[model samples]
Every structure is written in C-alpha cells, then in structure tokens.
Target: MRTADSAAEFQTAAQWQSWLSQGSTFPVFQPVLSLETQTVFGYECFGRLDLSENVASLGTFFRASDQTLNTLQQEVGFTLAQQVAQFFSPVKDARLIVNELPSHLTALTPLELPSTLEALQQAKFPLNRVVLDVLLEPGFQNPLRLKTVMERCHSLGCQVALGNLGSENSQLDLIPYLKPDFIKISLTLFHRSFRDRQFRRTLEQLGRLAENSGSALLIEGIETAEELQQALQLGARYVQGYYFSAPGRLPAPLPDFQKKLREALENFRMIRTKRIQRQVTWENEMLLRLVDISFVLFEADGLLRLNETDLEGLSGFIHRLYFSDLNGFQISGDYLLSETGCQIDYRDVGRNLSLRPYFFDHVYKLHGRPGGWSLSDVYCDENSRCLMRTFSRYVTPQAILYLDVLWANFADL
Candidate 1:
C-alpha cells in the first residue's frame, strides 16, 4: 500500500536488515492449471503483507534499493519457498514457482547462506520440485553467473523457469541451453494487442521447444475467458491466473477431483479412438480398392480429362470414402469435378468442411506406413464432429493423402 517515495522510512539499513532477518511477513498461493487434464496443477508463491512502516507497494519496495533489496528479496523468496515445501508435504510433487530477481541470485553469495540451504534440506522437500521462477524484468547483468547459479540450483535438485518471457532476444535463446522445466509468459504482454499475434506465435514456437526439451509453458495473469482460451489454443501446457482460481485460500483438503476428472476424460478419449480405429480397420480393404479403382479409371493422363463413367466412378469412390470404413467425407460435386481429373455429380462437401482435411490427410499418407493406417488422436473437428485421419500415399499422384474418417455415433456421449 506504500509508494517508492514513502518507502524512505522503511529503507533504513537497520530496519531493512530487521525485515530481512524476520523473514517473509505472509505468503499467498496462486493456482496454476494443467492443459491436458484441465485440472489444478500447482500454485505460484506470492507475498501478502501490509507493511506500514517500510514500503508502500510491494513492487516499489522491492525495487527501490536494488543493491540491498535484491539479497533481501532472495531471502524472502527462500523463506516463503520453505513454507510452501512444508505446506505440500508427504506428496510434494506439485510445482511451487517462487519469484526471485536475477540480482538476488548473483548478489547473495550461496556460500554465505548456509542456513538457507540447511533450512531447505531440513524441510524434507526435494529441491527439484521447488522452481525458482526468475523474472526477466530488470534482466541479468552476468549470464555466466546466472547460469552457474541455475546449475547450482539444479545440482541441489531445484528447477528454474524463466518468467515474463516477452522479448525474443538474447534471453529467449538462453532458455534452450538452460533447458528449464517450465516457461512462464506474462499475462500483461499476452493480453496486450487484444490478442498478441506475435506473442501467440512466440508461444507456439516456445511450446514446440518446450515439448522437445521436456519443458512446460505457463501463461501467467490470465483473468478472462478470452485470454485463457487463447493461451490454451496456443498450446500453453499450464496456466496461472485469476480465471481458473485466485490466490488467497490456505492449504486445505484439496480433493482428488482433478484425478477423477482426468481419468474420466481419458477413458472417454480412449473409447472414442478405439471406435474410430475399428471403423477404419473395417474399411481398409474396401478403401484401398476404391483408391485402386480411381487410379485405374483415371490412368496417368486421365486426370486431365473426365468421362461420364469416370465421374460416376469418382462419385462412388467419394461415397465409399465415408461408408467404406474411412471416416471423413465431403460432398462437393462442383469442386471435386474441377480439382480432380474426373467429373462428379455429388454435392459439394463444402470448402470449410472439417472432415474434408482428415479425409485426405489420413488415407493417402498412411498406406503401408507404420501407424499411418490407424486413426488420428480422436479430437473433435471444426464442425463439432468427431473425426480422425488415416495418412497414406497414392502411386498415381506420388503424394501422401489423408482419409477423413468421421464417427457420428455420439449417442454414447
């Protein structure tokens, strides 16, 4: 509640030292959500205090005297971290990301803080689960020292996650090498521009990297459905914000609701995929025959021109694309006629058809290839219809194709 100018009273050397020695005033837990399971994953640690004497605002107080406050903040962070470690006891697997300025890691010599390390060890919590979330606000002065500190943290079993990832400059490059377990994007930047086009792209790129590097993306400061939706769409594996839940609740009996929900969702997903696979397998031979027939009737040059018989056969082939065991089917007579070498009287499957891509994406790309004959990861298509694809290659066009497979029997759902 105090500003930088009013923080002078609390900025004295003795008072500051006393506050640091006294440790954190209070701590708050902000929830983070899991993308795959849509459940509460973990909480980010934040300070909650009404410091009347020293600092007006937490941010300003923390930043006013950088040289001294940096070390104090680290101490504060470690104390709160230990508290969190104590809170999630027995099965302390959930991540606790504690914010610490880069200056803290560099300024406070680890050699001098034997008590801090000892306290953490005595806490009986594995260091790896306690993520020291380093914010890239003021940035780091020495990359080598930061890397060394990060390595030391890792050596001690603690993990590091780069927070406030907005710029794609030097800091972004350092993440791949550091190979942190998680990445946190600031909601301020993510929500700016209504929908951050560049940020979304960056999220996608980072998400891919995280996937390969075994890291997770946590979108922070999410307060609205629109932001949450956008973050999820961009492949953020985890989210931290007010939309899912806010910070304040004390550690209570968190029911195993998330576990049960995940199990149910996973079960349904498996069932859906299994059903699609059965149908795809059933149509395999028939669909293969259809492809062969289309190739034979059209020939190499036959694709350039179409006869009445060819059109009829193409129509039948397209029809077999659905009924023959494959999933997706588009009923576009006009577009199909113009695109393919043959003519067809079937109705337009529509240009924006969701199943249309799967129809081609799966079938042609998968023929005889390992795992290609099977249906895709059973996900709902754009049309709100359940669809999967079989990828295979055709000898005629010498290109891969997907057989859009659809399963409309949602009576079970």
Candidate 2:
C-alpha cells in the first residue's frame, strides 16, 4: 500500500481505476431507524476503501474516479452486496439500501440485472429486501432510460429510493415522474433552508408528494437532537445520521435508543408549548394595558373621543385605531402611526362595519360582559405588509374601540 501526499496525487483516471480494482473497498452500514417502531428500518450501505494515510476523504477518492464513475460504482455495488450477504444474512426484516448512479442504470441490458442485483440473488436474498438508492448526479442524459430501469427494478420485486433530495444535484421536479418508494432528504438542506419561507414551502410540498405517492420520507444527515425533532415534525418515517449512530458493522438493538428519542421529543414539545403560552400571555397583557389607557382617556374627557394626539401617547406597537358605533358603523377616522407622527386617514370613514366578523362576534355578541375585549389571531396586514392582531373592546355604550397592534413586537415570544 502506497501513501499519497494529497488527493490530487491521484492525478490520472487510471490511478483511480487501479485503486478501485485492488479490491480494498468494503461496505459500512448506517442504521435507518423507524421513528414509529423505534427499530431498525434498514441499513444504508456506504463504501469504504483501504487507502493510504493521506487520502483526505472518500469524496476525494470518488472525485478522482469521475472519468470511470460507472465502472467504479458497479464494482463498489457488487462488493457491498457480497459483504451484506455475508455479514447481514441473519437480519431478515431490515432492508439493505445500496447506492447507484443514474447513468449506471442506463447501461443495463433489458431483462438483465446489474452485478449487485445478481450477487444478491445468488445469496438467496429476496429482491424486496433490497432498495436501490439512486444518487442523483448531473449530466443525466435520458429520463426514459432511468424510468425503464426503475420499472424493471420494480418488476423484479425491488424497491427504489431517491437519495440526496433537496441537494443541488437532485432534480426535485422529476420526483413525480420517478415515484420512488422512498425520498431521502439531505441534512444540509435543513440547515440552509429552515428559516426560508420558500424552502419550507418546498419541503411541505415534498412531504405531501411523498404521502400522496405512498412513498416513505427518510430524512438523512440528522446529526443533532434538534435535527431529529425537525425531521419528526416534517413527518419523516425513517431517520439516519450520526445522531443515532455512525456508520459501522451491523448495530445490535440499542436498549436506550427509544428512551433518548422520547426524551428529545418531550423536550421539543415543552419548549414549543412554553413559547406559545408566552406569546398568548404577552398579547393578553398588551390588550389589557390598552384597555386601561382607554379608560384613562374616557375619564379625562367624560366621553371617549380618541384622536391622533390620544393615540400618539400610546405604545409604538399600536399601528392604527378607530371607533365603531353599536350598529357596527364606523364613527371615527383611522388614526395611524407613522415614523414622523400620527396621521388621520378618513378614506374608510362612514363605512359599514356590521358585516365584519369582529364587530358581530366581539362587540355585538360580547357587548355587556365586564372587561369585554377580543383579540384576534395574528394575520398579515395588506397595507403595512406586517403581521398584526386586532383588539376590539366596548369602550362606551355608543362606541367600540378597534386597535391594530403590530404583531412584530411579540413575534419572537
């Protein structure tokens, strides 16, 4: 065995082919556990090589073999199957997940199986127990070829899984057409796209797609408790990553695996519940504070006639204020707060508010109750382009005060 100074030391494609042909490559299994059953759903097979000291990473090894990717991948697949057949023979329930490139599928002759499939068959392993995890790569020439391969694999009692989903190489738009039995979402996407609304929407859409197509969603690369919770919340049926266990020999039943999973879930729930309670409490307190201020204004004038000046003295979170009559007719102008000063807009004045849900449900319905006030759920305001909540209260016999509170103030709660 010769040690290379760096990955670039394997300069030529021949060097890579020579390294792969030396038969030093072997498979390591990573358990994909079922969240529902707390048991091993399957083991994903990753290829490891007996390389010289300075190889850097397996990724570098694969990159050097780009020119002969198909050949190297086929060799790896066969080796992995043989290893699985030997060591993982007694595991009847757990599936074997083997990765293959899309282009390799195109090279297969009709009605003929790949070397890995043949090897598995020779070992007397049921085809259904093997999942061909397709690694989406660039330069995929033919969709028809890939589809044919998938159909043939299915006919042979094998299952297909689309791996590295949400990664740059993954063609998400082709998911519907591929219709894999499983979709493996990469962990990197969660780190990058968690806070992004569009990406979250895409994730939600993928979840729905998996559900509708009868495909199980597997969230891969989960390496932390938070990541595990996120995967569970996103409805992943199977999860795999170092958070559970690193890739190694066949894992025995982890006695405390279920305990740790349940603890993480409980912690997540507690934190979420506390946050919601805090938000609700904050909203209630703010509304009550506004009610107190309204009473002060009423006592000062002996009549509740709120103007721009009156609203200016209030909290900055109050965006707009107006009053409605008992019959749900607007009686006051819209007093709006601005960066410079408060402004009164009369555009919507004299408009009927009777049909408004808040008017009938809050004011008219709960009019006579003591300290009667209704705070609406957070909603986007079209004019301000900000989240807001409307607080409505009966200030006087003839008037109902409507206060628009900026939801941004309590957004983080």
**Estimated TM-score for each candidate:** 0.54, 0.67
User: In model 2, what lDDT does residue 257 have?
Assistant: 67
Candidate number of the best lDDT: 2
RMSD of each: 10.0, 7.5
lDDT of 2 by residue, 1-413 (tens): 23332445676667767766554666677888888787788888766665644222244564333555556656666766887788777876898887777766777888768778888898888888889998777556677888899999999899999877888767776678878999987666766656764465467668888988788899888888878887776778888888878777664555666786778668767877998899879877786677557333332223234545555566566788888777877877787886678777877777787765455667544646835778776666666777777888777667788888887777667
Clashes of each: 39, 0
The lowest-lDDT stretch of 10 consecutive residues in candidate 1 is 316-325
Question: lDDT (0-100) at residue 321 of candidate 2?
Answer: 83
Instruction: Give per-residue CA lDDT, model 1, range 32-71, as digits (tens).
Output: 7676766666667665544555432244445554465554
Minimum summed lDDT over a 10-residue window in model 2 is located at 295-304
Best by TM-score: 2
